[model samples]
Target chain A: MADPAYRAAGEGALRIEPLGELAAIFDRRSQQTHLVTQPMPEILAALAAGPCDATTLAARLADSFDLDGEGDAAAILAERLDELAAMGLVEPV
Target chain B: MSTIRTLVDLLAGRRDAAALAPREWDGVIAVARAEALLATLAHRLSGAALPQPVAQLLGDARAAAAVATAQAMWEAEMARRALGPAGVHFVLLKGAAYAAADLPCAPGRQIGDLDILVARDALPAAEAALLAAGWEWVKEDAYDDAYYRDHMHELPPLIHKLRDRMIDVHHTIIPPTARPNPDAASMLDRAIMLPNGYRVLHPFDRMIHCAAHLFADGDLAGGLRNLWDFHCLTRDFQARGDCDSGTPDGALGYDEWLGDMGYRAKLWGLGPAVRRALHLSAALFGDEADYRRLSLGDRLFRARLLARDDWGRETRPLLRLAFYIRSHWLRMPPLMLARHLWTKWRKGRGAAR
Candidate 1:
């Protein structure tokens, strides 16, 4: 098994949290990460309510206006979740 | 006559790849892009336009982005100390160099750290230098460290103190215990130095190194990726054919077993990609048959060894004890195993406070 923190979910989804002080959360879904911005706190909160997939999270990306179009919604959420997982804020349930 | 069409055919038909599941779509995309960039780089380096099929097969954006990151990091690290006479020679090994030179495969396809081979005499100082520079030892277990130092050829792993980047520093590509320990020192001695004094393993040794790394190493978990590495490297070797162009030595040429690797990939059902890759790279890579014949037993051995992880706790200790016995027994004669066991027992008793 891979390190538990980077486990895979069903098809097209991944559960990621950071293992430690690594900045930038990883998106298990996209297997990438997004650098955090001030608007990220709001974005992350919206994601916490449920097990949202990449397409859903992209539609809810309200704070990425300064950035262009959806701005890697899948990659951003996954990376944030990875960071949160590393911090023990989120988990694959 | 139809190079691009052939590649598209290979990619399109191999859609049922068991290992290429969509859960790893991101990794897949990353690998595709990396392969595309590699094709471009090889074209530039060899001064020949890469065939259309090769370019199309590699053009995935995700894999390319990761390769771009790794390449940038590698270049920055090399450039930072490029001019100084700090006696630091950074030679990229395994996937990075292979991808840079040949192979339409992406570097990110095999997700792992960058492996660099330094001279053996410089091993200790190099380790110290990197440690001081910010890479921390990720594996702290003494037994594991001893295993790498004594039995293997390099350090375990080191992760960047700040960035999440990781690197594996090495003195040799193949372990000393594997087979008739190929003449590593001689290979290094003949290694060609690129501009900036950075050295790469002599072509023959580099090919053999890839073979040794994939087959001889104990890491079976990455078997699929390892096979992919072998396949890609073989293809790249065929392309340049410049490294070992004049060598009369049988072992120092790529002719020995490049075909064998291709045959083995097919035999193990690694899909037609291996065969296609061999043809695409013009048989510059592994010989499928030779590689297959040599590695069959080792692959079986690794599969069994890996299954030890799935055993229940009741059987786990027995397995561990068996490994302890086997590892010691084969490494030495009967007397040595007894002697070693006695020493271990005595040490355990002493620590039983």
Candidate 2:
């Protein structure tokens, strides 16, 4: 419950296309296209390597995204991962 | 009404969605819903310009379609697992088949029932396997069940207790008692295996099946969507060069292959249906170069296809009733149809009493 590990589906499961500002991700796993705005896309991209817990995923994401947020970055990213899992784009490991 | 036509034009990519006024958009939505093609129209108009409400509605429809498609595929997977132990390998049919094969008609296609075809000999086994896997009989009436078993091509419909989704196990495409019967065993023999451990009819069989379903088995209900499927599938086949033997006819080589491979022996007497299917598709969706003339009956059939009004309701009551009678007529001989209707009417009267 604290920092659940999550795994994005294997390659070719999600077809990510950039649409101007919002990114359109066609999740072949779910066959649902989601128009996402921010760190959600980055989180799934980071998880593409393999399954990892929230803190580790946050660390992986920090290389590209600044993790200096008022609310904890790991905490926020964990919520986004939960959201993605709800959408069936990522699975809770 | 013109609303259905607008919806079709939008789907055929002839009419511009952006140019539609707000009032016309409402009618488009209504007619699309009536024809059970909202998701398909949504996919057709996706990412294109749209009114705010229309876009929102279509976006929701797109999401619903995704869920429907996933659920459909899952049902197929479950059926596969269930039938595997029973030694019955089922071939996915219609929308399920299209989605599994990722056909051009698949995107945002609304799938209701999960249809599969097994060998006629395997009907009992397939029904047993499905029942064992939580699929329960939908009709408890003895007459209904017996009628389906005896006269229909498919087993009486079964619904999974948990999923609430229905499945139709078919041995053939149309009823045995119907006017035009297709050869199902040959289709099963020619079925192609997908990587996902499922099977679909061969491309040619799929086309023939669609045409047969539209022109032979059914009345003109939902004809537009079926015709669109025919159009898209034909275009997809052409794009993939399934018929690119540089034939002088400039028609699809598969059309000739329908002869060359001697599929004619199995096509029964469906030659006119296939011809009419192609003519209707070309007339509706093709450009001027591809246009084909329609017969007087074909014109009326087109009217039946577009008989919905602006409020998502069927408008032509008399025409609808006529087609309903015609469907039953085509489904059975005069004597059998009379008996079937009389029994049904007696039951209705008893219930009313």
Candidate 3:
């Protein structure tokens, strides 16, 4: 099956506070605070802007960061997106 | 004079840092920070052609204020959700209310706690729901708990067990013993409900409550920020055509609808103090006649409002005490006030010992 398109739960619903490499996000909908790291923050920001599939998000992330050519960045991003979805920070649009 | 006046003018949009001396900026920033108004000052002074140093100072304060405000918003939302399941509708009050309603006064404003006003009858249920949701009463002292239940307008505050944030659930704006006894029912009837199911006081009632809170409730220690709230709420409501225009007779024209609320003297006193603090004229608040009646009181309040040193310490300690006594006097009967003061003093002395 094709990977489902993902997007942030809603605009302005998450309050993110970055402390060095780690960040805290307070989800207004679930009233949950989640501590996230590195590429997750970038991923959330991208999804918050608008919905896109893993391929599109991977492309954007590749441009923003230096990715190793040995492995598939899209699969890594898809795994991270699933974890975020489980946390209720993002949803399949 | 330069510090307070410059800060006021900056907030009123009448002046910018270009007109202030380098030495004055330090005092101005100090006073603003002391009064918990640094963020508000920062927000107001944004986009002005301020000196680079002043701009940086405001930027840092604004960023800090934004974080504090965001945390406050989260607490308020938590309170709303906790109380929602019990079918209790509560009205957000003061700083929390301003932020929740997205009022103009909210940007960069500092909120210390989450305050919500529920109907007196629903308070028990509301309290139960909050407790069930992990909020615990903050006061454990027997006397303080009794005092809150018997004399105060609100319950002893509750703190979220997990978050360590405080919430004050008030049933009314003022103590039940206060002489004015504002119509809580009327005020509640006029509350505006937001899409999120949270309610806020009507513009007129909110303004009156702010005036009463500053002039009659406590020592005027935080009067500057309270007065700013009054100014912002009035300006916001007037711009929206939500408030009645004052009369030409100059007899506190705004009091036409407010006269029956029974706090005319207190409301009248707030007019001149706010005017003096913001460098505004009597005409701005529509209480020239009332201002004339309370001119001496106005002078006293203005002095207290401006008597703070750069560090926000009272320059005139005696004057501060006098106003402190005056606030208690306004809140209760003479005998009750004396008795209450004695009890508090004794308790404090015992604690010290």
TM-score of each: 0.47, 0.76, 0.74
Give the top-scoring candidate (lDDT). 2
Predictions' DockQ, in order: 0.02, 0.13, 0.07
Q: Which segments of candidate 2 are over 4 A away from where they belong?
A: A1-93, B242-266, B289-292
Worst lDDT window (10 residues) for model 2 chain B?
Answer: B241-250
lDDT of 2 at B305: 79
lDDT of each: 0.48, 0.81, 0.75
Report the TM-score of chain B alone for all candidates.
0.54, 0.92, 0.86
Q: Per-residue alpha-carbon lDDT of model 2 for B1-353, expressed as tens digits?
A: 37887887788898888988888988888888877889999999899999888899999999989887997886786687578878998899999999988888899887779999999999889988888778999979999999999999999999988667899999999889987778898889878887767889877677788888887887878888888888887777766644322333235465575464235524576777777777778777776423336788877677787788888888888988888888888889999999999999999999999
Candidates ranked, most accurate by lDDT first: 2, 3, 1
Better of 2 and 3 by TM-score: 2
Instruction: Write model 1 residue lDDT over B110-150, tens digit each, in one string.
Output: 43476777778777777777775567899686866876787
User: Residue B102 in candidate 2 has what lDDT?
Assistant: 85
What TM-scores result for chain A when each predicted structure is judged separately against the true chain A? 0.43, 0.90, 0.89
lDDT of 1 at B31: 37
